[model samples]
Target: MSRSPEFVVKSPAMDIVIHSLSDVGPDQRRRLCEGARGIFWDTAEVKDFSSETEREGFIYKYFSYYMEREPELFFCAFSDHQVFGYICGVADTRQHQELYRCADHIPLFDDLYGEYPAHLHINLAAESRGKGLGGRLIEALEGALRTTGEAWGLHLVTSEGARNAGFYRKNGFTHEVCRGILPEEPRMLFMGKKL
Candidate 1:
């Protein structure tokens, strides 16, 4: 794959840089993994963990696992060398299907895999929220995906009433499917947007 462009988002607080995972060092990745703990700290997924280690593992599964397969599609947002958040996915989902299939716990359905081809996941630190940074992350992710090889669009699995659904819709994605495992609510909704 050719090199992807980087972004510099100006803010009164700091200048946030958005780029591929490789651009950042291991320390940054470590800090990211650490700060990532805060992203879902309050979510049921992590809260249900019986131990701290299990909670950490849950974070790693959704955040870092994809980086192992497609670091290029994993975009990181940083400021003063500190990772604030990221938007990463499989530009070529075929490369990571086996890993997803073999997982002990599957977050998504088998047939739903890669329907959007280049699905993404995003998260930001507390200080980084409410600054329109989330949209910027998606814009950068979409921009990079468009420059690469054929990728229909990006898809993300999020449940109804989750704050993220609003951001996804505001960014132009439509609710394509809702797997209702929560009775009247959707266990998960696949949100997609064509590039």
Candidate 2:
């Protein structure tokens, strides 16, 4: 696995370090993964789970899928030995489409596979928001993909009209399209950026 150079961002009170998950030890990796799950559940826009089973089902689809399938693409932010945020993605959405459709039951984004081949998901702890860690995570993932030269661009799907849409826009993702998975589901905003 290619390792991203460890980056340390200094804040007024402490130092936050960004590390490629592939470079971390097993213990640290486990801790970061646990922390990431907590952050994902807490910060997720679709958190109106009625049961633990429902919550775990969403976690399996959105968070665990990437960590289990493409752990090399995961980047994490840590401060004082605690994980506060992470970014993870796939290099090719076409490959992800096949796996997701068969394994996770997620509908394919086939229409976008040709132009925007890569896609990402990011989440930050409540205390870590507004600190620019989200942007750093995106940059780290972009740098990793650029090294591989396998993707033309990146895309992400988020809740339509959500507050984070502006955040993605600030990071250079443009609204490409809006879609709904099922008749009962809310609309999803598809955003893309040339890498």
For model 2, the superposed segments whose C-alpha errors exceed 4 Å read 46-53, 97-99, 102-108
TM-score for each model: 0.79, 0.89
Report the C-alpha lDDT of model 1 over 3-78, residue by residue, as the tens digit.
4777888999789888776666787766665554456463334367788887667666676686776777777787
lDDT of 1 at 32: 61
Q: What's the distance in Å from true for residue 91, model 2?
A: 0.5
* Candidate 2 local distance difference test against the native: 0.81
Residue 139 of model 2 has an lDDT of 89
Question: Candidate 2's residue-wise lDDT over 20-110, tens digit each?
Answer: 7788889998988988888887887676889998877777767787888888788889986788899988999777654565432234356
- Model 1 residue 57 lDDT? 70
